[model samples]
Target: MTYKGNSIFKGKFFVWLALIILAVVPLFSGLYWQGILVLVCYYAYAAIAWNFICGYAGTMSLGHSVYMGIGGYISTIILETKGVSPWIGMIVGAAVAMCLGVIISYPTFRLKGPYFTLSSIAIVELLGTFISNTESLGPVPIKGGSGWSLSQTGNQAVMFEFSSKLSYFYIAFALMVIGLFVTYRMSESKLGYYLVAIRSDDDAAKSLGINVTKYKLIAMAISCFMISIAGTFYAQYFRYIGPDRIFSYDLSVQVALIALIGGQGTVMGPIIGAIILVPLSEMLSAKFAGQMSGLNLFLYGVVMMLVVYFMPHGFGEHVVSILQKAEEKIFGRIKRKAKD
Candidate 1:
């Protein structure tokens, strides 16, 4: 029993130790790898937001890209036309996203299983198509299919413009840390319990006097708000935003896949997924280039298949198990050495 307790402690300790190591990686890495790490942070942040509703509430939304697109477009447009700081625009975009998310989620809560998932996909399609054809919303240029590129206002910290890759890395890393912290907090909250209850069996929870729709809506709003912030980060880091890319079904799918593959209901699942898949993706795309364009997708599919079959609960579940074994081996050796 003592050993089991210590093993849990060891696992959690090392997991965070790994995070500490990730923080310093940008210092030694070149601009290219730093860029990749930034992307990993982006996906990780986005995945955590997605997991809140889909993983915890079992909503299975695939339309998250809409909020991201909205966030990026809003911030970029504001900065371009009004000279507003992206810092301020981020809050504005997140507010818009939350409102939209709640409005969209209200009716969708009536859906079930695949119907809900399909409706979400439809929403993304509808929004993306609308934005693509819209050149202007009144006086503001929607840019239509052309997208927005934000000009740098020097390396101004207040403006959210950075002259170095390390600046973006710091911002991305900070966001990821905040995300992880929030997820950990949620896991211990009453809201988390309600969400888990809703996920397990909404009908039963509703019968027990829980306002199922209300809680789900709350989760949806929170998810949208969080994801939209990441979208702001996305536009800021990349210096560009496009409906075709940000609102792409592929982006939504990848974000969901990361959380699901890592372990949907687990807080660490998305981080683990991003860490494993993003680097693998970068490597595969680089190695294959023109000839094997789809190799990454092929491998991703294989990984998804394996994870579903072997770790249906998610790879997050196995992390502790792996650590426990390592603890036993190391501690046993230490004891033997002391005895000898």
Candidate 2:
């Protein structure tokens, strides 16, 4: 086979191997690690959703948590008030988020760079405040000091509540897999190229007849819908949601940070970021619980600084480069031996 064909085969092999390893993790690990892996999948899925717009389309939104909050609140409210299954609520929440995405894009897309980022921040605060103050929307105020909850109703899969961390892990893993597939598909599509072009130079892309506004909205809608689905899973997993908790600016920043650290614009970047950062954060938090109040967060900042300094393009890209070189060297040796 040609070198390119060989490289593709090697890549696929590794991909399948990694998936199988992840699939079997819960079989050997205890509850704590299972929970950690669930969190890793959740954050990774959110990060991948954020990457579609921020990484590929170059739209830096600092208010994505708004969609998450919306998803959580909508799904929870429907389950409580209408007696509908959360499975149906998940779809409704995503639809609502997609509509919000269009509305948000209209105003914010006109602004670029820091201005857009600032707009997103403002939106987050506005949505949080709105939810907190608006009690008419639901029996329980979504942003009220008390927040909302979902009872452990009958039927695990139907109610979307699970008694086992293993179940949560599998659900989260499935979502993460879906997110990864979508990211890979989008990155390899013509839309992906258009997004990159718009991101690289909007003026140039417009000159080439690209509809910047339409494409930006498309990316935004897809990103919002994906994250909203994650929000639904989060609510079911935790059995609780509050405006302050789900709609925090910090959550938005965390997703962005994950993508940046993992290698934005690449399919594996967010997943890599989550795999490394989530477990580390959990370990640090567990080890330092009550002993060092802010040490874990402090350490996270330090690690991010180091990553920014050393692997500016993202650790994921750097790792990929290393692996490709290693493979090339090994294959080169095999070809040489065959020739001899």
Per-model TM-score, in order, reads: 0.93, 0.92
lDDT of 1: 0.86
What's the CA error at residue 35 for candidate 1, in Å?
1.5
Q: Tens digit of lDDT per residue, candidate 1, span 1-340?
A: 1212113234676668778888988899898899889888899999999998899899899889999988888888898999899999999999999999999989988999999999999999999999999999999989899888877668899999889988888888888888877876776677788888999999999998999999889888988999999999999988889888899888898899999888887778898889989989988898888998888777777888999898887776676667667777988799788999
Candidate 2: global Cα-lDDT? 0.83
Highest TM-score: which candidate? Answer: 1
Model 2 pairs in collision: none
Give per-model CA RMSD: 3.1, 3.2
Query: lDDT of all the models against the reference?
Result: 0.86, 0.83
Per-residue lDDT tens digits for candidate 2, residues 18-125, read 678988988899999998999999999999999988988888888899998888788988898787888899999999998998897888899989999999999999
Q: So what's the TM-score on candidate 2? A: 0.92
